[model samples]
Target: MNSTRFTPADAAELYGIHNWSSGYFRVSDKGEVEVTPGPGLNAVLPDIVDEIVARGESLPVILRFPQVLAGRVRQLNEAFRTAMREYDYQGRYQGVFPIKVNQRRMVVETIASAGYEYAHGLEAGSKAELALCLAQNLHPDALLCCNGFKDDGFIKLALWGRSLGKNVVITLEKFSELERVLKVARQLGIRPAIGVRFKLNARGSGQWEESGGDQAKFGLNAGELLQVVERLRQEDMLDALVMLHTHIGSQITDIRRIKVAVREATQVYSDLVDEGAQVKYLNVGGGLGVDYDGSKTTFYASANYTLAEYAADVVYTVQEVCKSNEVRQPTIVSESGRALTAHHAVLVVPVIDVTGPTRGLQSIPEAAEDQHQIVKDLEEILANINTRNYREMYNDAVGDKETLHNLFNLGYLTLRDRARGEALFNAILQKLAKLVAGLAYVPDELEDLPKVLADKYICNFSLFQSLPDNWAIQALFPVTPLDRLDERPTRQGTLVDITCDSDGKIEKFIDLRDVKATLPLHDPGTRPYYLGIFLMGAYQDVLGSAHNLFGKVNEAHVTARPGGKHLVELFVRGQKARRLIESMGYEEDMLRGSIRAQVDRARAAGRLDDTQTVELEEDYGEELLGYTYLEYEE
Candidate 1:
């Protein structure tokens, strides 16, 4: 391999860290990733990892930057404010961070505290989330939006918010929720503020496009909407309607679809105002996309427009529609959860081991004289392989490999010969790969050889526990090495999580032009190597499931103080084996007793000594408190 030199700026541009990180992370001059917690301050990521290790924390920990969260909130609000001022719109812009994006207490609390300037609020989709929001000491005027199907308990909690003088708006997703809201409000002798989620005819563009339009699972139809208005008027509660909400979907890449939905939602708001319902807020619900791949295209993983452009389109469309109808412009509210939180947290995992077909074999061994004929054929193919006839040699190698396997199964070829044949086949493939590396266009038959030659990096993390989105929906997150930015990577590999399941691997990676089949990485020496998966603070945390009994990982909330100082505001340890089993409804004491009984039985049978018994019991007890992940010394 040639010696290639790289700069901090080169690494930044290569991974598009600047595009999505929003100035919070960059490659430093020390050839390590630097965290810009505050303006003109920097902290290296390797140093942070060292600090975390010093505290006895394990690998696969989440590093959160609260300043990045605050910066996003500021960017969203400031963009809308700038757009409203540019368009001369009278209504103000207020946005809420939906708790579903990242329901962790630290994440939600950080957003709430940082968003105080913008009067930023919280959006809850479930009862527990609603109760959480109610418990937070949010700004008095901060809007609390309740969505989804509400039970009696959920509605009462929302009503309780109203009684406490908070700006609580219960958005009716289904028609039945309205009756529950009304009945609960009547029981409490409080008039609750209400919002209606409209099922718009315009469909968004992306993975969640089906979340909107007439066929959506949520929201009321035109006839149902009219019935709601008529019933509210009959009950003398028309004035309670204060917000009109519609969500086209999340991660909307196209700007035109947003403009269309905004226009449609504003028309509904204006018509409701004309009907004397007194709706004061026009809420175009969350669809703000993040540029995950930094391609700025209409791809499923990228956003076609910038946040400022999104705000401008939303502000201009609403203003134009209201002006055309001669109705007063209502206050704009956006529930952009993903955009606010995707950049706040990063999942850092270490590459523990590297495995590949060529991992052990250094050179092809000379074929034994008494070797099987098929093994000899494979060796000949490897020996005769050259640039002119690599394709033919590859075909011969494949045919001989299959035949050797068949012979071994039929008791014809010995295990020794089979191993030699397998090694020779792989070695030939590696040689052919090098020959084809410089080709302008590889042949179709050899196109997949490079992928087969790709190394498998065994990382210390659970795919199902940490990054379920990548496993479930194939979502692409930015992945790059945290250090060694000045040297070029000499190997290509795919990340394999430390799970027993074969599906727990990340094969697709983000590239500037298109999706890459493999990620370039360095050889893992005696020291530990770390890679970070960026922009995972959105739905990954809450949506993750306890697959393979791997629970939540350790989390550290990092605060970049002035004078380039770093502080860990919060540290949450990962789940232990006993806790993980208990979470699955298995009693820890009962399991321990069962294991202890087996050990005592062995001791009684003279299979153990006192020292062995004590050691066994101590090991068992220690295993209970040990981390679920594999622990190692760095």
Candidate 2:
């Protein structure tokens, strides 16, 4: 046992739970992770998971908190309102949720309903999203922001939405899109609400910075924007332009960049209003960042500013710019999708097994006189391992391990002998790691001793299907145990998901100060271990691929109940094996016939009897009907 007993606080510190969780989660006294989606609402995550598992649900399930989603919508709206009040701004603030962020029906409906009081609308970046937006029961006054490239059909659909009494603002992505929008509106015999996406000189600071600025694929340059204004004026539709839109980026890490973008957009908006266009809204598209790592610094995974700071800067900067330009302040519009949705979903998986250098090593006996020379050398190294000679022993172990592999390759050592040598080497490395930990100044070669001996936890989830951001963009969502947090974690580990791809592993983890290669974890000897990956409700949900045909994981819609309780109002099972194969161009009936034909051929060749053929056919049918993920006995 460790000299110091672990408490929930220690576990919290170890996992940096507070740093990245954003107060939605906390370590309880019972060592369980508790989620508080709203005030006076609390639910232990493990308890909820247990109840779910009892109902015969599998691991790698998504837990969606509608309260968190609603709370985020309300929080952002209130923040902007408070900032506008404090700054004495003239215009109101209205936000729109971008359906491209999550795009699920439930997520879209939740945000729309939650922000109804604020008249929050939806933004669509594609034709498919535009069609979905047209069907929604959005507030009559809410603005349905039509962004992205548009064709004739896309424009007609958006314009038709206007005929239905929708506040549809079709923001032109490029200068050419305006003609098509106007043409469609003329065909419908209704003047369309128009907006222009302005390409700004100021670029945001983050991975998505290139997606904005003058060189961006979307939006119109200043020169092109001027052309659009002159064209709209000639068409006698200058007053139809109701909004000026600019995108800095998504997940912007610095506050200064946001203020700069706001200044540039406000200047453009004021100029547009002066140019005889009735621009009443300034759209700062989707760049309010979420702090994935809790340091609150300017790191890429975090934001240096708070929600209050973001709101204050945006409202005040626009106010200052508009006042200087001698124009009335426009209604501030923001499409903050990441921060609104990132903390509402979590992926819960189980640690099915653990693999390490010293996991199953048995006690080594004295080296026999007739043992291989490499075996004797390993035994000698382990016997004399001490604080003073630990560094030298580590070096010797590394060299010996190489020689051991060579000897086994040359067929000089048996499997048992190789196992013994490997076990002895791991044991020496463990002792050296302990010695190196206590050293004030360690040699450079020995610094990696701890990491080299770290365990690999085989978690039961597909990284491609469940948590793709970790694999795609090096996204760092918080990973921690669901229970046993009161006890100290003795193992340092990295997670390996159950994907056939060699890249299906999460080695980089978020740290307050730096990126970590391993996470502190408790050992799961004979018990089932569970882990929760937090802050994955944003891009991770819809951006995942069906790589390896793993399909989507199960989903549980966790809604807050009366008296501080929570319940899973909806449960969605994962994809079955049959469906996955069918998607790969294999029909079920055809597959069944083909498989039966193979069985008949085998039996005709005398390879199987009738009884054996029946058993094999039944087994093959069962596999096609089962889940793609591995199953275990309850």
Candidate 3:
């Protein structure tokens, strides 16, 4: 019989960071989580947390590794290149980072700078994004694809991109958009390149599967696509139809679904080419899924294939379809935004407090003979717990606890008796939990005893503000301690945020089989305990809402040099109290003046002394500039 105690290394295997981190994160010798930009370099996350605290900054900081972003761009492009070479494919892979995934300036500029050599492009889905694309230093030969519903201004800006000597393609989602494209091109007197998003009957699979297929909100029907070609031909603008676009959905886990979509889109492209429409680019829009849970299954959060396998499937499918259609191999472009940026940043928040009996086995007070029968029964259950009778004892304890609650409500039991009953019941649960862990096979009745004994750790960040997907769609992101990987974690806890709402907590955590009810964590006795939420660089920042007025956390851009030296290139402060109030339409000056007036009125009425009045005014100013989060004192 072996009785090996579980350690922090066990936590790593449980969370699957080694499988999903893509060689960028590892456990250090000191048990701290180390973030790597490349070979021969790493950043200690706990040290960064220390530096942040030393600088008087708050918790819940988001650290962006631009090096990681660059590496991902290289990884994606290289995967395609390798696949193309292996298959001896005729067409080149031209990938574009969709701005909608992460529109932050540092993220977009890092992609532009790192992907210039591979001729990677940018995809904008709206006018604002088009303006952003226009300003970026993209490769002269790289593409600038304009998608989504377009107005005249949006169309004009895309045509202006062409005038500025960029390969800009305005993809038409509806038949009416064609007229807008033509009208804007005529007004600007610039030849506009166009693409058509054909609605694919093959639907995707996942949370966003509904965003694709025949009845999707975007994309043109078969009839509409034909009308676009025919109308362009009538106007002698057939040469302007340079690309065909279709997206099954975002975060597509099944590679089979991807191949089906590619084949369908390729057939549509070949049909248009056979009709004499000059389509030179087959834009297979993004569905490259990230393996969030490291399961590598078709589970909505996991991808069934690797980057190389995905590229091979895409390239081979397109090549085979075009070969059978007897059409020339068009260039393949993918807008893989999620897979590109999801690993580049991490959200680090501190566990400020705990709210359960994590200390275990507290001294239970004896119930008096005059107390209710339920309290006496709970005391009896606690006194008689043993291996053979633990199951029956636990059940009896549960029953007695319920009866004690009812007795308290019915005025039959005193508050002291109820309290003692709770403590005894909890203590019994802890003892049973320890015994259950040592058992090779626990009975099915008490299988969940250990989990039921887990604690609730209150972290210093808002779940809605930092991880909206977890709240909105139950998207799982990997979370673990940045330090203490060497020590055994005795506590299993679910994270509760500092928000007032009951829903602002994360109970489900990533697991190999399914989501676990709690996360394994160590006790944060007196030191600051930091938890890093990984793979949140994609849609989280842009989609995060200011729920409960908990604004964005401070952001830091960390750049790693070749010599392993790190630099915090930029630090954007989070929204302060005044800014948040102003964002909701209250004038800052007016609010300040009103506060000053109230203070003066109180002072004149002798409600405040001279020292108190000065302190009050100074405190008001300080509160305005204070971080919206709870500031911890050492």
Candidate 4:
């Protein structure tokens, strides 16, 4: 370690916190990660967690800043508005937050409440989500867009929005859904507003490019779309067509693809106007990307374009196409659910333990004469290794460790010998790690030694329950220590969750240059340490699965008020064992009875007295009602 001073700025650069946090988060002078949710309002993340812990809450809690949520909503809408102003666009911009991004009541309600000022609305991709939207006290003019496949009941519920004076648009996912819509409208004797989702010839760039082109799972082909327009014309229902929509997928990376898609969709929009259909809105459905990696590249985890650039391309491209076609410009609609919600919720997990190949592990001393030949060879490498012979000694130690392992397995050495050999090997690697860092250039084989020797941090949260996207889709979220930015990180490590599954660990982390196989972390020792998984508000909460029956973690909703004040408005405790099992179809009473039967059997077999049986039953009952996660003693 050098004698130079380290600062929070250095830590910020090391973790790329400023690179990906947008503007909502930063490190304070006191080495704490401070979140500024609104003007003149800020809160320290560790301080909030301390408050929760003070109330006897457990590890792995989610802290949501509704003010931060409001900030994102405002930022997105303002981005499009700025684009429109800069591009001199005549079409108005309205953004809708699709509930599928994060169907939690607090999340959706925050967006709806913040967005009502800009006439922003809700988009539902399922019948249940549509019901969720209908229950909100949304702005009267906000577009309540009902997407996805529609049954008769789905269409009827959406049509009922018209009776209640809500601006509901039933978008046709497929040609067949249009028939169901018409049937429901006829039965209700009300002409409902309609939107057609078109399958574009232009494709997007990223993991979900197929969501736009002709191979899309939903949306109508050119011929099918024309047929719908013609049939609507025949039934004098063409005027009900109020919106033209297309989605190029979520998290689109490239700006060129968006420009292409917008141009193509606008051409179709102009053609529909020429055919006498009254379309008031051109909806470019959700694909605004969040730059997860902060690289600003076309990587799977990053976006190559800024939100401002995306808005400009959509507005300019549409204006160019509509003007060329000599048609009136329609109101621009965007359902940018990801961009509006990915930054508000932070999942804070505790580091219960830290491990490595030889972390705090002691080796026994033995005479050289009694040591095995392979172990002696490793001991020699440990003795003579330096910056000069380090390369050769590293190679020799690597070979000797394997041979030592084989000799132990073959009964040529005892457990103590094996332990000594393992310690020597870890020592050799640690020495090589230091030597390789000072070298002008390291060999390719030795370059990865540092990452391989990094520590393993055992976190107290289940990745399957809190950050499922990272497991399922390889989404990279920024991981950083909540406090301790003033000190230098002494080791690198990967995050391992407390799940039983072998795959429940975070190996890949976000980096400005590329993905990191390991994260720089501090040693927690006997004290409590915390790590936060940021930008997890989008889809992660709703998409998580209860693998190992972990269920949901505790959640705290923090509202940042003016004058640097904040309040913990709500704290939602996680699922208990009883609720988890009951949700899995196990009756609570039956489960209790089964345990009681076992206790009775034990009592009858003279394994317990009456007092002991009663105590055991009470303990078992209390455990059943306890939190599903592991409990720690205070």
Candidate 5:
């Protein structure tokens, strides 16, 4: 009998998640986590996961749900289209996927394929990314936005794209860039549509607030913008200036700030049009945020408004400004990379262990005769009367702890006595705090203490390699165990990655006080604990590095079929030892041969027996085929 009670097979039947897909987590009929099945298993997850594991894959792997990506594209398009229609907005809304967010070929291809209907396009910030966008063979009508600082090569590539009949818009970040674009366009004999990135006086709120305002690195100031227009006019290339672009920042939280930024940009559009700049589009650079916490409240990395609300605001605000200026409504373009891609991928990691507070005395032992009075005082405090006396009792217990510490320091008590006193005092305080919590009068610091004391699960995944934004900028992503969503999570624990670096631990978590310094995880013993880090599809992939040589995790794409069956396809396996070695500039074949020669020499010298040699060779072979480190299993 298969000892696995819940498998990926079960997850597919219930959760509607399919393999080869990159989004949704397939929950089993019995409420378990697994890859959604493919057509072979009627697209059930348990069978897929079992098959993969049978092939020697591990428990912790990333399952990509492609349907989620398709769905997100559809949702975004429908939202903007609806807003445009409802408001009778004259200009259409077009979206572009920023390449800097995620440059993976599969991800970009998927977005390009799914977004064909909406004239959705790709945005590139670098030459390589521009090449990828150009190679995508995007829909003929789609816009191809080229951003970031430009060199001769980058401008040449954009102009070349235009020569191929691609709707390439080269956004000028600096005034000098226009000179380069002109040079490139003239050489290529292709007048590519030009866009000027305007640095606005308005500032947005959140982590990316600096992406706008006076200090913003990108975009031209008012004087620079005027100079660019004059230069373009002098060269008779003014008509090529078709788009006015401005990006306040990524993950903008406040809707009001966006309104301000848009209003200001809209006025700029009017001013440019009034000056005969021939502006046809207002490209609001990507700032759409994700609701990582599910709180629906604005956070540093989240937006205050929904997609519909955001689209409506942009359309209405732009229309009002355009009507007032008597200029035709310009087409609205948004490089909303985060909101579009954030929900498309989920990073699933497994819990390896649960750590607890260090062991100590439970009650005041018989050794503490001199500190007996202190223990008695703690007990009295623990048996407090009511809220009226709770503060007074807490103060008394604190004083007693200090007195006991002083006694121990003065050599009046032994280490054992001090330990007993500390344990008793802590126990008493815990009890009192629990009582106060019941009455809803617990101190702010003590609010989460009870939960913290309950459990501390140590997960097996690298925070830096997986969620760099969370570690670097304190960006919070939704993290919940892939399995056991049905059961309440009781343990509040900091996640510890496999890296030896001290910074690898995730202590700050999303909470009311702050984004979680740590997360509340379930005990691993009860089940195979796996956590899903959601809304990380954007930026995380490209930004991730092999810190400590921990390469990417095993990845599979999941897709939902029209019928009930789900399709789970293994898109890419995690990095193999050979691949990692090659990346680090070591030839895998040479390294293997050298190691084998060493082993053979050892065996010839009688330093290793035949059995040991065979075992060592087999282990080494396995290492070459598997991920960087052997996942430690308890």
Candidate 6:
């Protein structure tokens, strides 16, 4: 029996649990599969992968555990509920799934269904998103918030939602949007709740710092807020203005910054109520972050506070502010999309190849007549080097290379001499750089040279299709080999995606202090090596493009029961090549006909015999009916 005790760091390394644990995931002794604590992922993963393979799926698959999603929703609601009860706060805490984080059907549906008990809702930013939210969210009491820039069409959708008896809040990002909302509501004969987004001067900390402050793109200014109030009063719609909203940004790492924003936004809520605008809810838009590095430090992609601490801070701050201002404590609503959704999905891909620069050269060899002088000179420098004159000797050796290069170019030395001199010089530099690295005084240029010299692992996934944020925004996702945690990794390599473009490489990685150029992975072998891209459940799916015509990967939804039996359910296979072609504006039948015509032409040209042509045609026809990309095998 294999016995390996994995820490949270190991779980983060294996399953991509960067933040506090929400899902019930555990690794068994042998590490063959990471299972939910009950039935074990060992029983779950093989069944899931086998079912997918039986259906003829390929590598680079995304295994989504809906049980994890359900667990996250329950934890989020429980944290707030526990805080509310413990603090004796007067108002309720309700959470909405920000559809922007992940707009997939299974994810949204699972969150909606699991959160039905807590009245958990969905927040939509666009018309299409609104349609999705309305269709999936069957929770009658859950709030459906319509945010972002609104046009007449968007406002109409919000009003339409209100007519369906759903708790639809149209949050006005700008003063002009208020009139659109009022017009649409009047036309549709539905009184939709109104919320004004406040542009607070307070700023947040982390990658999404631009989400708040006076320079934020969304939200109404002081002047605009007052105008909106006057317009609501004149139109006899002040009663509909029931919610006040503000957002600091996403991935907030500083707890102090969140406290500051909550205080400011709470003051804004108090002022709205004091000015005769009915404000019953405070919507602190999503800023809760995940601790990507698991350090609990203030990094760009992480947070410093625990979920309970964050809830306590928000509730306690709001209660104090409202009490001091002589206003009723408003119900707290949070759209903490990333924190709730970033951990439920994991992308698994295989390492196909590894490459690096050449190695294994000491001093330049003393060859025949031509290269002997260069070798002799190199040996003399190595022998004469002393502690006091080592630096000067190294500099002098560098200058000799330039002189040797000129001599070779002018035909004064043979190519053999030049090669020997170059080899000798590089070997010396490598040794010096290693010594410098050991002394911890490596220059910036030399710091990444070791990684650059290491191999590049060609992974069987597309950066454009699987991890667009890493490619477009230079975002770093935690990547670690799945089954090799017990053994220490020895190879350092960059990850190259399966894209035809040169830019499809993942060289930037998340380190302890900052981003790095390469990751340390295991050496390749006969069996397949797989790496899981962590914390990608939030935004990678819907934002992914079919760049290079690579469509989505196969998806599996696993659920862990209480008794330890894992259930593996295939959600959807990825887009077929024919389906991808149809999506790109080509008719499937037309594409098939064109392929058949080419095969016939090849046969007619005598390039293929009768049997070969028949086999070729059959293969092409089967591929047209099959899924995109070929299956990856060892």
Clashing pairs in 3: none
User: For each candidate, what TM-score against the reference?
Assistant: 0.97, 0.96, 0.96, 0.97, 0.84, 0.86
Q: Report the C-alpha lDDT of model 4 over 460-493, residue by residue, as the tens digit.
A: 9899899998888788999999999999988889
Candidate 3, residues 276-327, lDDT tens digits: the string is: 9999999999999999998998888889899889999999999999999999
Give the per-residue lDDT digits (tens) of candidate 6, residues 476-558. 67776666555556656889888898989988776666666767677868866877776688888989999878889878777
Task: Please write out the lDDT profile of model 1 over residues 1-634, one tens digit for every residue.
Answer: 2325667677777777887676778887767887885677766777878799898888889999888888888889999999999999989998898998888888888889988878899999899999899888788878999999888899999989988888999999988888888889989898989999989999899899999888898898878888889989999999998999899899998999999999999998888888888899999999999989888888999999999999999999999999999999989999999998898888999989998875534655656779888877776777788889988888888888888889899999887898888888888888888889998889999988867889999999999999999999999999989998777777889999988999999999988798888888888788789999999999999888778788889989887766446788788888888998898899988988998899989999999998999999899988788888888864
lDDT per prediction?
A: 0.87, 0.87, 0.87, 0.88, 0.75, 0.77
lDDT value for candidate 4? 0.88
User: What is the model-wide C-alpha lDDT for candidate 5?
Assistant: 0.75
Q: Tell me which residue pairs clash in candidate 4.
A: none
Q: Give the Cα error of residue 396 in candidate 1, in Å.
A: 2.0
Count clashes in each candidate, considering only residues at least 3 apart in sequence or on different chains.
0, 1, 0, 0, 43, 5
lDDT of 2 by residue, 108-128 (tens): 989989999999999998889
